[model samples]
Each structure stands twice: as structure tokens, then as C-alpha cells.
Target chain A: MKIGIHGLTSCYGCQLSMAVVKRILDVSEKFDIKYFYMLSSAGKIEHVDVAFVEGSVSTDEDEKELRMIRENADVLVAIGSCAIHGGVQSILFSEGIGYEEAFKTVYGDKKMDYNGRIAQPLDKFVKVDYRLPGCPPEEEEIMYYLATFAIGSWPEEKDYPVCAECRRAGNPCILIEKGEPCLGPVTVAGCDARCIKYGIPCIGCRGPVSDVSWFDSLAMSFRDRGMDKEYVKKRMAIFASRYEGLNEMIDKIYGD
Target chain B: MRYLKLGSRNIDEFLGRISNYGDLYAPQKISEKFYDYRKVEDISQVEFNYNRTITPAKKYFIPPKHEMFEFDMETGEYTETMGDVKPFVLFGLHACSIVALRILDGVYLNEYPDKYYAARRKAGIIIGISCLPDEYCFCNLRRTDFVDIGFDLFLHELPDGYLIRVGSERGHEIVDENMDIFEEVSNDDIENFKKFEKKRHEMFKYEGSFDNLRYILELTENSPLWDEESEKCLGCGNCTMTCPTCRCYDVQDLPDIDGKHGKRIRFWDSCQFRSHGLVAGGHNFRETKKDRFINRYVCKNAYFYPLGTSYCVGCGNCTYFCPAGIDFLKNLIKIRDVVGEVAHGEQ
Candidate 1:
């Protein structure tokens, strides 16, 4: 019943998306919105039923807050692409670019009192009970999960690939018909493939489906379509960049 | 078990009978060798045996730009608009596309009920037709069969008339209401149906075996050819847009010029885009094209399998539409071969 929402160095889309849900329906009667940095005044923390945390942990301030929240909350849910994975911020790790260089790029020689390392998802700091993966969580999905959690019956997590949904939606085979490089075959299904439905390939934003290794044929199926090896590696790395096994695969293909 | 012996003259009568329920959507020729599904007034206008359409049957259930909800910014109020639902008929759905639809149903309807999608889906009836296979089609390879998922109705062409199988209660209703137009199917006619099904199987052969897919991914991980293969990629994102399975999207608030009023919208996005995985502070996880490209493969082939569905359907649309002519099948073979060679110390 008591839910706390917080964000650290994120686009705030996930929190905003939850707000959109509140406006759409009278969910207040069902949920007690206790602590939210954006929606309400920052107040003394208390024990909560569930804590919805968004964004990657990019600052020491965030790490302290995240640790405290994890220790107190019964359930911790990573609410978007950023929190579920290191998100785009993890790209810095790939290039060995530190936060100092990033700050310099923006401030142009301005003296910074403090700078930290590149950011990572909250899971790197503490255990995450659940994940609603997307650039911004889908409203329908958010509502479903909330309702399920409220009833004490957790919604079964979908481990299927996006391709299953894409096919079910009756969209044309984009990879075959349009020769587009798509991540659907590998990406997880949650958004009902709104992107592929609207004439686009999946970018693997929802992270890997479940057992990424089982769908190897689907990946090779891309190659059978004449996609370059480098092109496939780069696309797969978008969401699974933090996944050591996936990165190792990329290293083997591209030679470090 | 009802058969319709429609002489060329009774085609109009057939169209008229179906339209009484609601709108009838069927394939229409847009240009030479291109067809699109649209509402048809006359049955003759429907192209029943066309290869495939530019878009799949998903448009009916999930439109290109659908409003999930409308928000009034000043009032800070939101209204949920339930998608329109009406009983209508979808004519001439192919086997490959229908299988795609079933896969989507498993995701949206089974696990988490998508009310908006379910509403629109309930409004339509699927009537499938087996058409000539296309060169790019590999539905059989994926083990998706024609007429497998129970459609409301299925049509098979014959020399004299058509054989109609009523697969659902709604389909039987249409037949029962129009008993005057149909004749009971004979035992010989059933045998003919089996023949046609067999012929279809013979026509569409699996080009390659899928058994080695997992091993292929393992071998490809360290293959050096990926570097050389990705050089020509333009990152235009066309392949993903046209794919049946690619579902990644970007959500943004589209505020008006005044920056006061805006609607939150979700649009189709591609990993191929440079900023797809970029964060607010300007860190891109998959910075290089090589990494992004490889990520796509791992997700589809490796990651998606664990999730309970294979994202790629082996449609071959990506190969056909690539402007730079990236051949997915050939590249897969090359990776397999190269990876095998390296393992054997022969490369």
C-alpha cells in the first residue's frame, strides 16, 4: 500500500509515466503515495511496501539514498530502461571515458568542485525486486503490475522475445521485407511491440528476453539476411552492454 | 463442412452477404506487384492470392499512431479512450502473417491483458487464404504452418468453387445464417483439401536446418568477420521499421509551442539510431555501430530464446529491403563457416 518513488540522474520519464497513469484513473484510493521526490516534498523516510526507483546511480548522493531505500523497502522495482540496465550512461565504460572528461565537455574548463565515475544501474548498488524495462514504462503495463502487486498476486514475468508479440500483432516481417536490422528476435516483449507495429525494429531497450543463448538461430537468421557481423554485434550491445557474456561475444567478433 | 459453389457471377452476392455484418477489409492492388489491405465495397476488388502486403495485419489491431489516452494539460486531467470495437471480417490473411498475429496475442492477451489492443482485436474476424509462397518466406523453417491457428474461417480454392472451413463459433454463425448459399462438403472434397495442404508443404521448403542456431551463436561470438561485414551499414533503420518482430520504442511528451500543452506519445524507435541508448547526461552505452549491430544479434538469437519466444521469424524481409544489400542469410552462413574454421585451426 505505501509506495515511494525516486529518481537519480534520469530523464524522469518513468516517474512522469506513473504520474500519467494517476491522472488517467483514480488509483489514489488503491495506493498510498508516501514519498516521491518529484510529486511531493522530500520528507523523513519511513518503511514502505514498495519503492519505485528510476535512473542510474551516477552520484555518491544517489548511492547513499539508494542503499537506505533498499534497506527499508520490502520491494524495490527498477522502473525504466535507465534503472533496469546502466542505460546509455554505461556507454562511458565502453570508451574508458571518465566523468571528469564528460563534465569538461559540458562546462568547457569551468572548475568543478567534485566529479565521480560513470553511472550504473541501481542493481549494481543493491538488489532489485522487479524491473519494468523501457525508455519510459508503458502505461498499461505499469497499471497491470500495480494492480497485481496490490492484490498480493505478483504478475508472471514475461520472458518471451519481442518477435512473438510482433508476429501476433500481424505486422509484416520487417527484417525480411524491409531489410531492416531489428532487435525484436532478441529483445524482451512487454510494450506489445508498439515500435515494430509502427514500422520500426526493436532496439533491445527492454533488455534481453530470458535465456539469450537459446535464440541464437534468430540472431543468425539476421546474418542469413546478409547483415554484417559488426552490425549485429553493435546492435546486440545496446541493452546488454553491461552483460559480461554478451560483451565477451562482441569482443570475440570485433577483436577487443 | 459447408462448400460454396460460387460461379464467377455469384462473387458480388458473396461480398454483399459478408458486408451485412460490418466493414470488410481485404487486399487491394496499390501498384504493380504491391498490395495493401483496405475496406472493399466489391468482392472482385479483393486480391486473394497476392504474395504479401507492405504492412501486416497489425494495423487493424494496433494502428500506426494510436492515442492511448488524451490529456488536458491545463486541467491536469486525463481521459482514457477505449479503442473502437466492431465485428468485422479480415479477408485473405496469409499463413506467415497470421502466425505473427498469434505470437502477439500470446504476449498482449495472455500474460498482461492489453485492454486497448484486446478491444480492437475482438472487433475483427480472421478469414485466411493459402497463397503462393514468396522467395523471401521461411515460415515453414520456423515450423509455422498454414491454417494452424484456428481462424474464424479458412478458404481453399478449387476448380469449380471454394471450400470453407468454419473454425470458430462466429464463423459457423455466418454459415448458419446463410445456409441458402452453401452446399454440404462431400468426402471427396475433404480429400482434395488434404491434397492442397500437401502441395503447399512441397512448395515451401526449409532452406536450412535450425538445429545449429545455438552453436552458431557461440562460434560467432569471436568471429573476426563481423568487423568487415558491418562497414557498409548506413544505420538508416529501415529494416527494423518493416520487420514483423522488432518492437523497441521511444516515449516522449510532445508539448505544443507554448510548452504548456502536450500529449505523451510512444513512437517506434530503432537501436540502429545513434542516440537510441544515450542517456540524459550524454552517455551512450552502445556507442559504436559495431557494438550496436552485434547487440541486435545477441538479443534476438541469444537473449530472446531464454525469454520463451524467438524474435526473428526468418521472413527474409531484411535482406530484400536493405539499401546497402546486407544479406542476412549469407552473413549467417559466413559466420558459421568462419567460426567453424577458426575452431578447427583452419582459418
Candidate 2:
């Protein structure tokens, strides 16, 4: 089947992650890598079976490319945290900041390139058939998705918190045991509890799982562990500030 | 049952002998208050004073991730093989976990029969230990603080030595092989055991009859408690997966990139997951947070209890293990303590 790996306003980390999946899974043997902007010079495509879009729409050019790719593909997958939950670039978006002030604040008077706009996830503009959420979508998840999609099925997402996988990994609860403020209970799994395994606490890069009510509970629990309430809010806002539920929790606790 | 005494000084050698069989697993101190079952090279690292490990001994038998068999797509060939199952001693199991093992055996060894889990059980020898309860433990509430028939051997820790009980033939075999490390239990050892039991009971905090909980669970279908808890419920499955009695799972194929070679694997699954209850037409029965949150309590009490087995071991793994620290017993206590008239089927 013809597959296109597209990138927009990103660090190209997702594409790099897909390259790792490509080498590990030997994806080129099964798939026709027709229009990966990073891989091939030949860009134009009439139609494709699946289009994996990375990054977020942060420009008029990005918006048009995403729409065109959506029109030319049967399946459009949001392939990373950027395309799924608006990545680190969406920090300003969370604070409701605009490009003019954002650019001026970050890089004063350096006016050059393209029409830059506030970043947003792909589903905000067009339908995303699936979302593989992570800082760079987990390598195994991308492999699992492609392997299942090859057989005309889709893999079920691991929607539980990272604490579940951490238990499976047989790691001690860093938060409860050592009194560290970890986000494993509030964040999504499928990262194999990566941060927790290495003795570092989870920063919740993949965002909170759906149907989570205990984001506030976890935040307060961290507060109970002697962390400031604002510190807990700021940590959550680092990765999951865009999620309405997390924001509601932040609002409930801080009344902002 | 036979009673013997082992000096605390000879523990490492006795355990080291058990390791000669194959592998010996003991609870290792992973963090300040946490312990986990780890393969032991030195018996000195084994500890029994911990309240709860991240997982119970059930994890050793059923496992969190298990490869059932391997398959090759080239010729439609499948190979089912019994994995390595050398005999090993699981030393320092808490009294409550011995019961948890029986609970797991009743399910996996029943009609359907999981051969993998059965193999693990056959190869594993249980050595129960004395556990002093803390504020979080409620195992006594569920009558899991002691066992009579399940373990091969049990060690009651005393000041200078351990009072040992031989429950099965395996326990006798161990004693016979290591006669140099054991001695006949004296009158003084019996007195020590009785005193230890008294102090163990005193460590428990929540002392109330659990007889009325089943009724409270059965009648409270529409309680607002479900809605109230859902407000803070992440439905993270930390409660159910850590639960010793909760044994839900899912099996799936893990094929290679070429789809030519693969293995079928089984892993731990939870009902709190969005797709766990999803059905035909993409309809999820437990769509709401309340539905998933309440179903867990129902499964523990209303569902698993009526089957004539202990469903909640009350080891307090879920209480302290959870990031939110949402205790199921607190919810159950709330449901049981309501003073008004019964409100049936409101949920």
C-alpha cells in the first residue's frame, strides 16, 4: 500500500521516530514509501492508502498541506504528541498567546520566513482516524499499529495510567514509596513506564488518559507530599494543559 | 503438621539450600516502604517486615505478560511449548498472599485450565512468613491474616530464631534434607508464637464486621456515591490490577513485520479501559466514568463474592499503591454506613 509520512510545524522527531520504526520493523518491505518529505524528493501524490501526519498546523501553508493530504488519503493518522495534543510548541497556545507577541517575546525583531500562526492538533482542522500519543510516538506503538493495520485491523490503545505498566514492570511506586511527585497515575501508559523504570518520575508527556478524574487528586496528593500547589499545576500544564479535564482540575484547585 | 525451630543465624544457609533446587525468590526492599519479589543471590537481602509489594505472588504464576505459544505464517505452523519450569522456592510470602495464591488456583486450575499458570504453580514451593500489620493493612478484616493448608512451610519470626511449621510433604522433605539447620520446637517457642499472634492482632486498626457489606453492595445500585467518586476517578486500574483477587486478562497475536512469524501473548487487562467494555456498533456499555468506577466495586463484592470465594484480600495494596490513594474500603464503608432507607437500582 502507498504510505505518506507528512510533517508540519515540528522538530521532525516523529519522522525520526518513524525512521527508527522503519529500520526495526523493516516497513519498507511491505509499504511503498511514496511521499515522506524527509525521505523522498518526489513530493506530489495523487492518492495514497494511508497518510501519517506529524506535528501541528502552525501556518497557513501547514493548514493547506494537512487539508490536501486529508483529501488525498484514505487514512490520516496523527503520529505524535504535536499532531495529537499540540506538543511543547503548544505551550503558548495553552496560555492563549498569539504569534506576534510570542515571536517578539522569544525572538525579538527577527522577522523573516513564513506565515506563522498559533499551533493546533490535526483533528482541530480535519478528522484524524487514529492518534499515537507520545513526545515522539512510542516506537512499539507505531509498530503495533502498522502490524495490525497491515492485517486490516487496528490495535487497541493502552488507555490506563502509566502506573499500571509500572506495576507490570515491577517498579516500586516512586511517588508513594520515596515521596517523589510522579505523574504515573495521571498519565497514559504505552511508554512502558519509561521514566519510572530509570528511577526518574513520570512527567506525563503523553497526557492524561481519558475518563481520568483523579488529576486533581494526584495533584493534591503531590501537594500532600510537600510540593507547592502551584508547582503541581505548573508540572501538569507542562504536558497536558490543553486537555479540558486537566484544565478544569487546574481551575478547580487554583481558581484560575 | 510438624513444628520445627530455625535459628536466625542459619537463615541464609537454609535459604541458600532452597536456592540449589533452581531459583529462589524473596521480597527485596526496592524503596523505603515498598518490597518486590526478586530472584535472590544472597538470602540476607530477603525481608518480611514489608506491608505490601507492588504485586502479590499471583504475578509469578499468571505473570503480567505471558507468551502462550509461537506461530509461523509461512506454513501455517504453530508450536505450543511448556516454558522453563524448574522447581523454585518462593520464600517470605505474607499470610494474606498464601490465600491469594489459592484464590488464583481456583480460577486458573478450574474447567478451562491455563496450562502455563498450572506449570508455574507445580514448580513453585510456597514458604509463608509472619507479617506484622500496619495502619494500611485490613487483611484481618477479610480473615486473610493466617492460613492453614495452602503453604508447604511457614516461618514465624522470633528474636533469635524462627518457629517453623511443616504443612505438606514438600515441607517435610526440606526439613529432612536440611536437618542440620532445624531443631525441635520447645515449650518456650510455643509461648513466643502465642505472644507474637497477640501483638499481630493489635497492629490492625479497622475492626468491624464485614458480614453486612455484601448486602450494602447488593442493594446500592443507584447511589450518588458512584457519581461523587467519579469526579476524582481516573479509572486508572491501579485498584483492580493491584487487587489480588482481580484476574481479568486479554490475549492477542503478536505477529512480525512480514506477518510470517509471531507469538500469541496474554497480558493483564482491566475493565477500566475504554475498550474493555466496548461491543458491536462501537457501543461501550461502561461509557461513563461512573460506570467503570462503580463496576470495580460491584465486581469485587456483588460479582466475585457470591461465587463462594474471598474476592477482596484486604492487603491494602490498592490503598497505598494508588497515585490518588483512593481506597475501595473507604467507599465500601461509606456505602455500608448510610442511615437512610434502601435505594435499590438507582445507578
Candidate 3:
């Protein structure tokens, strides 16, 4: 099978994670690399069996490149939190801050290069067959996707919160015990609760689970723990701004 | 059953001798406020006064996650991945936890028995220990506070020693092997034990009757409290994972990047998870959080309560670890009150 790994507007961390996977040698032997600028100098976007697209559609150029990739590949996978949930850049999206206000605040009277827009998930511009959610997707999950693709199967996303694995690992409940606003209760889990195991709370870098992550309940929980509405909203929006009905869910508890 | 008294000083030496039978496992302090079951390399690591371990002793038999078998991706040829099963002496199990194992035995050891669980169950040597009930404990309500059998040996705490009850042949053998340390129980010791039992019973803070609990739970199936509490439920699935009798699991086949090799692994799955009730074609049986939240109680209180016993050992891990602070006993009491009001109105 032929595959392309493309990066549009990201830190390139997700692509880097996939590149440094321990089983890359075995994975490379199963698929032909058509376009992967990170791994090879080959930059031409051609027809491929699967295209793993990283980062969000932040610029007009990014949208065009993403559209071209979508047209060329048979399947498009939104890789990482940036491409799946708009990453941290979209944290201000729910705060009613648009690209114009953000750009003017950062770079006044400066107009150069490509047109900038509010960052949005890849699915906003084109169909996404699958999603690999994480700040930078886990190596094991990346390998799972690749292995499934190699064998003509698809990967299944976990619909449970991080607390499922976190409790099994026998980690203390930091959210309840320390009153930290850990997002483990409403975040998609596959990282084996890595952060919680190390005495750190989850930041929900993997974004929200599909239709099940009760953001309103968690926001209320945070409020009960003495966190203000804005604090809960901002913390959750860091990796899940583009999640469907997320703002409305939080609004139900915090009010409009 | 024969009773033997052993002084506190001889515990380490006795444990050292039991190492011949199997690996000694006991609760060890993981942090200031946490305890976990760990293999005892030395008797000093055992914390007999611990409240409860983070995970139960069942983990020794059925691990949280394990590879059941390895298979070829293309041909589907497989080989069992059950590593060498060995006997282990689990020391210092609380009475409630010992009863929890009995409940698990009914599930895994009857009818078409699970080979792995059966193997581990047969190899296990349980040494139960008496414990003082804390606020979270409700084992007395469940009638699991005091164990008569189900253990190889039971150690009842005394002022300066343990009143040991031999329940199995192994327990008798161990007592005979270390006869020098064993002392015959006297009339004063028996009197002290009765006084100790009375004191332990009076210390229980939580109180409720389980006589009509199953019936009340069955009648209050549509209680509005289910929805009210679900709003506070984060659906984190911590409660079920920490539960001693929750045996639901999810199996997955992970293929290696080599594509030829893969393993079918099983991991603990929670009913509280949205994926647990999810079916193919984007349909979920328990779509709402209320349904998922209520499912746990129904399974524990109504469906599994049979022959006058509850599936819930009342370890209280659910209430303790819950970030939302959903108390199981409080909910049960509320539901019972609501049902009682309705019954009174009808009469």
C-alpha cells in the first residue's frame, strides 16, 4: 500500500512521533511512501492508499494543501489533536476571539504572505475517515493504525474516559484528593493514564470522547472543587475547542 | 476448626516459613494514604493495619490486563500465553475481601469453568485477618464482616497477639510445623475475643438493613435519583475497576508491525463506559449517563443479590475514589425512602 504523511500547521510533533516509532523499519517494508517530507526529501503530493494528515487548517494555503491531499488519497486520517480538535490554537475560539482580533493583537499593521484564518479541524474542510487523538499521538496507537491499514482493517477509537485506565493502574485520584481540575473523567483514554501515574493530572490532550464525555458535568465538578467557570472552560478548550457541542455543553452548567 | 494463639513477635518467623509453600503477598503502603497488594520480600513490608488496598487480591488471579494468547495475523494460528502459574500465599486479607473471592469463585469456578481463574484459585492460599471497620466499611450490613470459612487460616487481632483459627489442612500443617510458637487458647483469651468482637461491632458508623434492600432496589427501578446523580457522574469508570467482583472485560487483537505476529489481549472493561454497551452500526444500549450509572447499582444490588447475599462486598472503593463523590449507601437510602413513601400512600 502507498501512504503519505503530511503536516500543514502543527509543531510537527505528531509526525515526529510517527517517524521515531520503534517499528518504523517493519512498517516501511509493508507500505510505499509516496510523500513524506519529514522522512524523505520527496515532497510531491501524489495518489496514495492512505494519507495521515497532521495539524489543523489554519491558513488558506493549508486548506488548499489539505484539499489536494484529500483528493489524492483514498483514505484521510486526521492525526493528532491539532488536526482532530484544532489543538491549543483554537482555545480562544469559544471565547469569541477570531483570527483578525488575534492577529491584530499580535502583529498590528503587518500584512504579508498567505491569508490567515481561524484554526479548524481537518474534517471542517474535508471528510476524515479516522482520527488519531493526542497532543502528539502515542507511538503504540500510531503503530496500531499502520498495522491495521497494512492488513486492510481500521483502528477503533476508545469511547471511555482516562479514569478507566487510571484507576486500574491504582493511581490516587488527584482531582478529588488534591482538588486539581484533572480532565481524566471526560477525556478520551488510550495513553494508559501516563500523566496520572506520574503524580500529574491529565490535561485532556487527547480531546473529548465521542458524544460521551460529559463536559457540563466535569465543569460543574470543577466548580464544586472551587474552580471558576472560566478556569474550567479554558482548561478544557485547550485540546477540545472544535469538539462538537462542547461549548454548548459547558454553557449548560456555567450559563451563556 | 482448631484455634491457636501466636504472639506478635513470631509473625515474621511464621511468614518466613510460609514462603516455602508459595510467594507471600500482603498489603504494603504505597504512599501516605494509599495501600496496594505487593509481593512480600520481607515481613516488614506488610501493613496489616491498612484500610484497603487500591486493587483487590483478585488481581493476582485475573490481572488487570494480560495477553491471553498470541496468534498469526494472516493464518490465525495461535498459542496460549498463560505464563507459568504459581501458588502464592496471600496474607492479611480482610474478612470482606475473603468473601469477595467466594463470590468470584461462583462466577469463575462453576459450570464451564475458566481455566486460568480455576488454576490460580486452586493455587492460592488465603490467610484472612480481622479488621476494625472504618466509616467507609459496610461489610457488616452485607454480613461479610466476619468470615467463618473460605480461608486457609484466619488471624483475629488481640491485645498482644493473634487468635488464629485453622480452616484448612494447610493451616493445620503450618500450625503443627511451628508448634513451638503456637499456644493453646485459655478461658481468658476466649473472654477477650468476645469482648473484642463486641467492640468491633459497636465501632461501625454506617447502618442500614439489607433485609429488604434487594426488593426496594427492584421496586425503585425508575427512581429520579438515578438521573439526578448521573448529572454528577463523570462516567470515569473508577468505581467498577476498583470493585472486587466486577469481572467485565474487553478483548482486542493487537497485530505487530511485522504483520505476521499478533496477540489477543483481555483487559478490565467497565459497564460505566459508553463503549461497553455500544453495538455495531453506531447504536448504544445505554446511551445516557443515567442508564450507565444505574446499571452498576442494578448489577450490584438487585440482579446479583441472591440467596440472601449481595454481590457488593461493601469495600466502599466506589464511594472513596469517586471524583464526583457519589455515595452508594446514600443513594440506596434515598431510594428506599422514596419507595417507602409510595408503599405507604398505596396502603
Candidate 4:
């Protein structure tokens, strides 16, 4: 099986994670690498069995390349927070803060031309067969997805709140124990609750899960715990600001 | 029940000997303020004074996820996934949790007994310990502080030693083995036990009276209190998952691609989740969260009363674990007041 590694607009930390971590376990025998810009001398990619695409569609160039990769591959996987939920950069876009104005604010009239309307995940432009969501996909979770997919079966993604994993890990609810405004209830699991275990409240970096009714009530819960309302709103919107209807939910709760 | 006094110095020796039989587990603080049942290899880690563990002892009997069976379809071979059971001594179960386990006996070991749960249940020798009530405790309302039955041994910690109540033959046998470590209780020890019980009863400020709890549940069936309380329900199921009496589960199948080898597992499921009552055609019996929230109170009060001695022991695990901070006893009081009004009108 020919596998291609493609990056649109990302840190390439995910691919580095694969290289650094996957080398020790030695699972390279599963498939043959066709095209990886970082790994190889830029091999031409005609077609591939599985194409792992990282990063979001933030540029015209990224959009065109994503379509070609989607058309060429049998299975397309969005492998990172950027590719799955539109990374940290996409927060600005969701807040209706134009990237052009911000870019000018930083560049100071450099007369640069970068053309893209809204930064979006690959699924917005083309279909994504599977999504491995995290700021950078955790190594063990990536291995789980790969091993299951290699066997021709869809791996079960943990779509529940992080509190499930937190409880099983025997970690006390930091939200309750320390009066911390934790996002464990609103965020997806499968990061093994790394934040909660380390005594940090969840930042919702893996994106939202089901059963949370648009996170408005969750914000109110934060306020009840004596957290600043502004901080609660900002924290809730950290990763899930771009999620559809979330803005409307925020408007309803905060009243514009 | 018999009494045995164990020296504080020999607590480890007695517990370590019990470990030879099987796993000896107790409440341990793995993180700061977060306690759960962990293997008590080091006797010093045993948190006998902890108010409650984040998870109850139920995790051992009915784990969060348990594999029931495995099947090989191609060769037509079947396998029942069963783990070996050995005698266990649960060292630090609170009175509330001891009662909670008895409540679960009604569900798992009812008309159709769960073989997996039954094996673990029979293997465990419960040793209840005294727990000082936190602000959230309402076990007094449920009268779980003083258990008439359920445990093999009950330990009340004194400054110098442990005042032990040997409730069963197993408790006696265990104590009899370590007669060198245990001494006969004196008149002062008996007086101390009485004092402890009185203080425990006084510690709990049980807000709700259970005189007509069933009638209260019936009266509040149409009350708008459910709607208000349910609004606070996060639907995260933290309450149900942490609850000792709540025994609902979801069955899952992990199948191999060849249609041959597969494992059937049972995962702990909660009613607060959206999929709990969802039918095959996608119709949900309790569509609203209010209905689901009140269903818990109804089950605790009315539905499961005949099935067991009591539906709830009021362990307060639900309140401690719920992210939304929904207090069960507090809500019960609100509903009971509405019940009073309805009953008085009828009179």
C-alpha cells in the first residue's frame, strides 16, 4: 500500500511525532511510503492507497492541493487539530476578526498577497474518511487508529467527555475538588485526559463532543464555580469557536 | 456480631496476611484529595479515614468495561471471557458503600444472576470503616451510617487501636487467624463504640424526612420541580456513573473483519446520556432531560423499593462526582415539599 503524507498549513509536528515515535515500534513494514516532503526527495504522487493530510485549508494553493490529494487517494485522513477542527489560527477567523487586517497589523503595509476567505478543515473542501483530533494527535492514539485501519476496520473514536477517562484514571474531578473551571465535560476524550491528570483544566483542544448542548450551560457552570465570565467564554471558544451554531449559542447566552 | 481490638502497630501485619489470600484493596489517595480503590500492597497507603473514594468498590465486581464472551465464527468456536476469582478483603469501605453493594445485589443477582458479578461478589470480604461526614453526606437520611447487615467486619478507629465488629463467620475466621494481634474489647471500648455511633448520627444533618417518600414521589410526578432541576442536569451521566445503586449498562460487540473472532463487552451506561432510552426506531421514551432526571428519583423512591430493602443509601457519590453540582438530597427535599402540598389538598 502506497501512503502519502501531505501538509497544507501546519507545524509538521504531527509528522515529526510519527518519525520520532513510530521508529522505535518499527511498523514501517505495514505500507510503502510514496510521497513525503520531509522524509523523501519529493517523490511525485500520482495515486496512493492512504493519504494522511495534516493542517487546514487556509490558502488558494492549499485548497487546490487538497482537492488533488482527495481525488488521488482511496482513503483520506485528517490527522491533527488543524486538519480536523481548524487549528489555533482558525480561532481568529471564527471570531470574525479578518485575517487580512491582522496580517497588516503585524506586517505593517508590506504589500503582501495571500488569498483565502476563511481557514477551514479539509472536510469543508472535501470528504475526510477519518479524523484524529488533538493539537497534535497523541502518538498512542495515532498508533491505535493506524493499527485498526490497517486491519480494514474503522477504529472507534472516543467522542465522550474527557471526564470519563479522568474518572477511570482515578483522578478526582479538578473542577469539583479545586474549584477549577474544567472543560473536561465539553471536550472529547482519547487524549487520556493528560491535562486533568497533570492538574491543569482541559482547554478543549481536541474539539467538542456530543451530549454537550452547545456549551452554554457549561459556561454557566464555570461562573457558578467563581470563574470570570469572560474567561469562561474565551476558554469555551478556544477550539470549538468555529463549530457551527456555537456562535449563536454564545449570542443567546451573552445577549450580543 | 463479635468484637475484636487490633493494636494500631499490627494493622499492617493483619492486612498483609489477608493479601496472601487474594487482592487486598482499599481507598488510596492517588492524587491530592482524589481517592479510589487501589491495590494496597503498602499498608501505609490505605486511607481508612477518607470520607469516600471517587469510585466505589463496585468497579471490581462490575468494572467500567467488562468482556462477557468471545467467539470465533470461521472455526465456530466460542469462548466465555471469565477472569479467575480469589478471596478479596476490601479494607476501607464506608458504611454508605457497604449498603450500596447490598442494593446492587438486587439488580445483578436477581431472578437472573450475573455469573461474572456473582463470582466477584462472593469473593469479596467487606471490611467497613468509620467515615466522618462531609458537607455533602446525607447517608443519615437513608440511614446508611449504621448498617444492620452487609459487611464481614466493621472497624471504628480509636487513638490507640481499632474497635472491630466481626459481623460474620468469615470475619471471625480472619480475626481468629490473627488472635496474637487482636485482643478482647474492654468495657471502655464498648462505651467508645456507643459514643462513635451517637456522634455519627449527630454529624449528619439529614434535611429530608422519608416518612411518605413514595407518596411524595407520586405527588411530584407532574410538579414543575423536575423541569427546574433537570435544567441543571448536564446529561454527562457523572451522577449515574459514580452512583453505587445505579447499575444500568450498555452491551457492546467488538468484531473482527473476518466475521469470525469477536468479543462481547458490557460497559457501564448512564441514564443521563441521550442514548439510554433510545429505541430501535430512534424513538426515546424520556425525550426531555426533566423526565430522565426525575426518573432517577422515582426509581430510588418508588420503583425499586420492593426489589431491595432500600433503593438509595445516599452515599453522595452522585453529588461529589457530578460536574453540574446537582445535589440529590437537596432536590428530594424540594420535591417532598411539593408532595406535602398535594397530599394536604387531597386530604
**TM-score against truth, every candidate:** 0.56, 0.94, 0.95, 0.85
Model 4 residue A152 lDDT score: 67
lDDT of 2 by residue, A1-256 (tens): 7888999999998888888764544798778777877776787765988899999888999999999999999988888777887777777755768889998988899876788887778888999998777888887788877777676667676667888788888887788777787888778788888888888998888866755536776766776678876678777767666666776776675566
DockQ of the two-chain complex in candidate 4: 0.27
> Which of candidates 2 and 3 reaches a greater lDDT?
3
Which has the higher DockQ value, candidate number 1 or candidate number 3? 3
Cα RMSD to native, each candidate?
12.5, 2.9, 2.1, 3.9
lDDT of 4 by residue, B1-347 (tens): 68789878888887887787678898888766778899976888888778777877888888887789897757767788686788888878888888888778877888468999999999998888887788888877776677757888888876667898888888888888778988888888878777877777778876544646767786667888777777766666677777777788878656643334677778777776566777888798877777788778877765355334457777778887778877887787777667675666543
lDDT against true structure, model 2: 0.79
Segments of candidate 2 deviating more than 4 angstroms: A22-25, A210-214, B302-309, B340-347
Q: Name the best candidate (by lDDT).
A: 3
Ranking by TM-score: 3, 2, 4, 1
Q: Is the docking of candidate 2 incorrect, acceptable, medium or high quality?
A: medium
Tens-digit lDDT track of model 1 for A90-178: 76665556788887787877874544558788888899988887788787677766765665545445544576556444456566566
Clashing pairs in 4: B73-B260
Worst-scoring 10-residue span by lDDT in model 1 chain B: B300-309
Across B1-347, the per-residue lDDT of candidate 2 in tens digits comes to 79999987888778888887668998998876678899997777988677777877888888898888899877888998656788988988888888888877777887468889899999999999998988778888777788887898999988778999898998888889899989888888899999999999988898855645666776776778777776666567777777777788888887776757777988888887777788899899988777887777777663243234357777888777776667777877788756245522322
Candidates, DockQ: 0.03, 0.59, 0.71, 0.27
Per-model lDDT? 0.67, 0.79, 0.85, 0.76
User: Could you tell me the TM-score of candidate 2?
Assistant: 0.94
